[model samples]
Target: MIIFMQLRVNVTEFCIDFNCMKIPSSLLGFFNEIGAASRFVSRYFQEVVQPRYEVKQFIKQCFLIGYRSLPLIGITGFIMGLVLTMQLRPTLIAYGVVSKLPVMVSLAIVREIGPVISALIFAGKISSSMGAELGSMKVTEQIDAMEVSGTNPFKYLVVTRVLAATLMLPVLSVLSDAIGLYGSYLGVNIRDHTSLSLYFFEVFNTLKFGDVLPAIIKTFFFGFAIGIIGCYKGYNSSKGTEGVGRAANSAVVISSLMVFIIDLITVQITDVLGLN
Candidate 1:
């Protein structure tokens, strides 16, 4: 009787252990991460409105995230416009409405491609950079040191980068639109003749405040999303050299996905509001 009772107890313990081990850790971890990220974002909003703002750090971040990023965005915008125009020309020519090319290309670039593409590029460059920088600081215990020294690391680091990204992306998108139009002009002249002034006049004539405003507004959200995600990933990184790379890679992936998601939401909102 004693031996049978002991055997029963051991079997019950084994079954409990096996059941516990069968739980999906990954799904639980993902939800926990989402909750953590939400809390982090909430903290940012709270800190951002408080006194003793980090103006200098914010300006430095603006220069680094915005000014330094111009060349890449510009080149990409120019090439995108040129390629889009060249590819579209054959189709427009086939339809025998090739005269509408300028308006069509301009509308496409200004309303959608310019903002979305510039944002993705911005995410690729800035998100990974922020993640890597913060991740390195985290792994090296610099963030811990900042806290120990009575400095508000989150306010200084995350807030500045987030604000810079929020402000800079719209400006970049505007510049990209202009450069893209120029590229489109060059593309138009490659196979057929069209005056520069005429091309631009047609482009501008088709554009309106409604089209430009919504597009620009969405970019602010995009920038904010990218900046916050990068900061969040890097700030919460694990304590290891490998954590730095993981943070950077995850930041890029998540930010890019966020850009698309934001774009989709914006489009839907615009459509519902009749802005589209």
Candidate 2:
């Protein structure tokens, strides 16, 4: 009983001291923002599974956010493969292991580089765009009008966009990996005489189901991070036009950060699973 009372006293004293201390405004704001975001995500899950699915809006978002973004992803993937191949060639040649070049480049691209780079690009483009578009709608009071009219704006706007992003990113990342491999093939031919069939033969031999699945799995997470953060930031935007700009800027930053965090988590999981 005495020990328990002493422990309670310590807790009460700590609470008193904590309340008495002057916390920095910036630190308080940071925690307040985190709490707000957590609430937003909780609301999302609650709303996502409810009835009346927005199929048409989801399709439209897929076309706009996914299909429209393909060319940029493809080009980036190609350049990534080409540059990587060129850079690795000299080192491999010096070690007299140039034969391992195709295997090395393909493993690197398919395993880590492609998914990450594509997701970063997606975050930069899609996240910022969602934030700005929704922020503007909020600023213009269109969201309020929708609510007044008994229209489900969150369902129409946030749900469809987030679902589209979650589904499309894996598809885009797979395509990027393929395109990067092709670019690597061309780069191989630039300095060395490697047949298309031979190059891919080596690449396919190096890549296995275990190697590819983890990379693809992480991309779904990356997309969710990009979509949810963007939607949350924009849906809650304030301060009119200034808030819209801040929402867009912060969405990109946060989405990009989330992608890296997810990727790191995936790597740790995969390593534990012996998929590394």
Candidate 3:
């Protein structure tokens, strides 16, 4: 009877542990989502390389994604530079490094703030837009129509948008940097009389290939992440109208998160390489 009791106890404990070790539905859902996204990425890569290049669509996407986005990007970049300069001036004065203001502002903008802020803005606008647009198409069965019509929907839609985003962001980032520097110049002059040439001279003098190249390189990843996530969410959207809104919202959130993660990784890499 004692031996029978021991066996029962052992069996109970083993059952308890097995139950404990089993994944909860919530965590399992999360893992399943991650796996789904991974597969989506793989599908994108596979579809992207296959022929029947959508050149016209790609150009249209570039114009829409790049040119149309400029005004917002420029305005935000200007304000960012101006606000940063105004905020930093007094602190620099306190430290007796007021003359170094241009250099400091430029470095901050170029190395980190510019790419990140620009990407977030781009993600907010573009990611959500892509998600909504694609989600709507998905819900309406336009993709299915295209498929039945013997058209390559993925290439025509996803590849063009993704490539446009990947290429355009770096250009947009460069423009934003330049505009921000101009705003910084104006900001510097607002408090004290600093010549345009002098402010730019100070800014350009301090920045090196190291600071600029890494920043540019990271923006490409930022763009790619933003585009891929947006397209993935949109292309895979389901559940009708409600899912469209969810896709747009999630795309913005995920892409913004990706931008920060990529930036952190880039900073770490540059540090390890002594670029910083």
Among these predicted structures, which one has the highest TM-score?
Answer: 2
TM-score of each: 0.92, 0.93, 0.92
Candidate 2, residues 1-276, lDDT tens digits: the string is 334445545545555578667566575566557666766776778778998888899999999999999999999999999999999999999999999999999999999999999999999999999999999999999999998998799998999999899999999999999999999999999988989999999999999998999999999999999999999899999999999999999999999999999999999999999999
Who is ahead in TM-score, 1 or 2? Answer: 2
Candidate 1 per-residue lDDT over residues 98-191, each given as its tens digit:
9999989999999999999999999999999999999999999999899999889999999999999999999999999999999999998888
Worst 10 residues of 1 by lDDT: 1-10
The per-prediction CA RMSD against the true structure, in angstroms, equals 8.4, 5.3, 8.2
Q: What's the count of clashing pairs in each model shown? A: 0, 0, 0
Q: Model 2: clashing residue pairs? A: none
After superposition, candidate 2 runs with Cα above 4 Å error: 1-19
List clashing residue pairs in candidate 1: none
Predicted candidate 3 versus true structure: per-residue lDDT over 1-276, tens digit per residue:
334445545555655677777646575455556666776677778888888889999999999999999999999999999999999999999999999999899999999999999999999989999999999999999999999999988888999999899999999999999999999999988979988988888898999999999999999999999999999999999999999999999999999999999999999999999999
- Point out where model 3 deviates above 4 Å: 1-22
- How accurate locally, in lDDT, is each candidate? 0.91, 0.92, 0.91
What would the TM-score be for candidate 2 when compared with the true structure?
A: 0.93
